[model samples]
Target: MTIAMGEKIFHHQLVYNDYAKLSRNFFNLGSLLEKIFKTTFLSKSGTQEGENTYMGNTGNKEIDVQGIFSSLPNVPTALFQSQCVVWKDEILICGGRPHNHHCYSYHTTKRKYKKICEYPHTIRIFGHVVVKCESDNNELTLLSFGGVDVSKYTLLMSYQSVWEKSRRKEKKKNEWRVVHHDTSFGTRKSNLTGASALIGGKNKDLLFVTYFPNKIDVIDMKTYHYVCGTGSNRLPIKSPYSLQNHCFVPLTSSNQTVVNHFLLIHKNLSLLIKYNEEDKKFCYESLPTCPSLATCDCYGFISFNDQIFFFGGYDASAMTEIDYIFIYAMKDRAWTQSKHSLPIPTRGCCPVLIGDGRFLHLVGGLAHHRTQAMHLATTVRAFDQVCFFFFFLSVIHLVII
Candidate 1:
């Protein structure tokens, strides 16, 4: 059974699958309610305003609004497979599909966008990775590398003190500096269309790049050189299977020992990659399968507390997009379907955590209809504020039965 109210949809099957095993013993009601209260209200830091800030009910009608989905300003252009990184108070959107080269900086507080710079004229923008790295002098730099472009080298563009200049109306043209054009890294096309990149290492000076099938590349941020040699920059562990449209998210845990761990997800398969600092090597461990894997693809994910939330994606078997949001708890090794969903079926949209990690800002992608081959470009921005308190209320109602 399904219920639709306003823009939200609730699936009875999902709720039943999760709560069907609950006992009907009324004596256990107190313990059950205690569990629900702790899980819904308390955050990882044991504070009411931390990671689970959105879940609290302050009794203020104006401030208590939760799980609300609203539209924001449209992007200057339709884009997907783009790269976004949070830089200070602004979000730098760079390199997307349709051979786009333009880059823009969206100010979070001002809610406005300013065209900053463009990718190199000779490079293709689609499927690229843009990340903030520190220079040798401890200055911040934006490093872009690995895309559909068959370029054999990586590029770096420094934006140090440029934001202040732009504010003062004295902006200067941004230039790309070729960091590594060495042909010795091989002439074979480095087409990392659906890859993931993150900054890691003991000193946080290493860039870890992972591409489809099974390949990992490590680069020294300061020197802008690819790390090579025995026990080299590449990880020796190999996967028995292949994955596409995957995502790598750093594990969010209170334990300090797991700080160097990352969770890699693709469909139902989830792997835990641990960075062994002693040997400077990485290893992987398989985790429980994701429940929504059978119907989710190209989804965006972000970790909070001990749970990972998956946003909209496509269902290849049905050839349709999905608005369902699924949550996987790392502690319980279980999945729960979110009662709230996106306003529309969306795919390939970038999911960004904003405002104390309570709200999710979804950028450009594609919106799909029920029928196949009918889709529209998602130019308008969407915001998803996750407040699962309503789901808790429904569970309470069921307990009364």
Candidate 2:
């Protein structure tokens, strides 16, 4: 008999053995049935090579087994502490450790990468932050700040020019230009290393920068100057220690109490910072402690569907890499660990969400190792959140057989 489910066709055959033989194996019915079901499911599922399916329960919900992780093509070189920004259908990957200057754009649909442009001779690209800001004219600009050298220069590149340069159609000598040579926050020089930048404000003209030792700075994008007259740029509530290798993700909430809000994530802290339009200052409220706070750092962090997902990271105390996937639900303010982990433990990888928030692409990072600095990773893995209908089909088939 032939059965069709979606685009896949499955053929099944039933064989009848002698009644005497069946009676002799009556006590083995459970084992015999298990074997039959396993064979039937594996043959009909049509799982491809290098792909894996997992079945289990996560708390009250049944884990999405179809939403599995699979490897993609390796990047051109192994990289760690790199930065990536999604632009249209491509992910533009910038510099990483080992003094890398080359940048490439990974085509999400084609699953290939093409070298885009190299950083200027003066800039060190690793540990930098890249953000996409759209101007009033609807033109997109890519802004880069901070790096390993703790450079004070801010770089800006035209998105259109970058695309044209990638196609070899532009004749410009340098694609990136130095926008500000002495960018600073109040009395202190900007610490670009391990810093994070986000575009905010009602007009989207303000750039919020969160940097080391718990400091926040707002820069006017139009004039490229730090706003200081309204209030001090530093966070009113300071962390116990300096924050390095931290990240800032904008929070989306239905609450109307604040004009702008963001979540600051670190190894040991999670704080909610809100902008007060009336006071022209930023205030913060501490959230629950991170579940993997003691064991993870330099991991992949992203916000999707009101949830924060943390990928693999290095455990400094244990001196080993971790492969656990931790997720925090924003609505419930609770953390749940996913049964699924990376194919291999990695740290400092770039995570990009594409295609309707269902496909998460994890780019290069440092693989599992004892040393803290070496061993750049080259693998790219993707987690596909397959539809629940597909999982329903598999359950139905198992019950019917």
RMSD vs true structure, all candidates: 11.6, 11.0
Tell me the TM-score of each prediction against the true structure: 0.68, 0.72
| Candidate 2 structure quality by residue, lDDT tens digits, 239-298 | 454666675788865422124688887776778888865577877788886756654577
Task: Return the lDDT, model 2, position 49.
Answer: 44
Candidate 2 residue spans exceeding 4 A from truth: 1-67, 135-139, 148-150, 161-174, 181-190, 236-240, 254-259, 370-401
Residue 90, candidate 1: Cα error in Å is 1.0
Judge candidate 1 at residue 286 and give its lDDT.
84
After superposition, the stretches of candidate 1 with alpha carbons farther than 4 Å from their true spots are 1-67, 135-139, 160-173, 183-189, 229-241, 255-257, 369-401
Candidate 1 residue-pair clash tally: 0
Q: Would you list the C-alpha lDDT of every candidate in the order shown?
A: 0.58, 0.62
Model 1, span 239-350: residue lDDT tens: 5434446677777655232556777777657778777656767777888776666646777666766777777788877888788878777777777776557655666767
The TM-score of predicted model 2 comes to: 0.72
Question: How far off is residue 204 in model 2, in Å?
Answer: 1.2
Give me the candidate number with maximum lDDT: 2
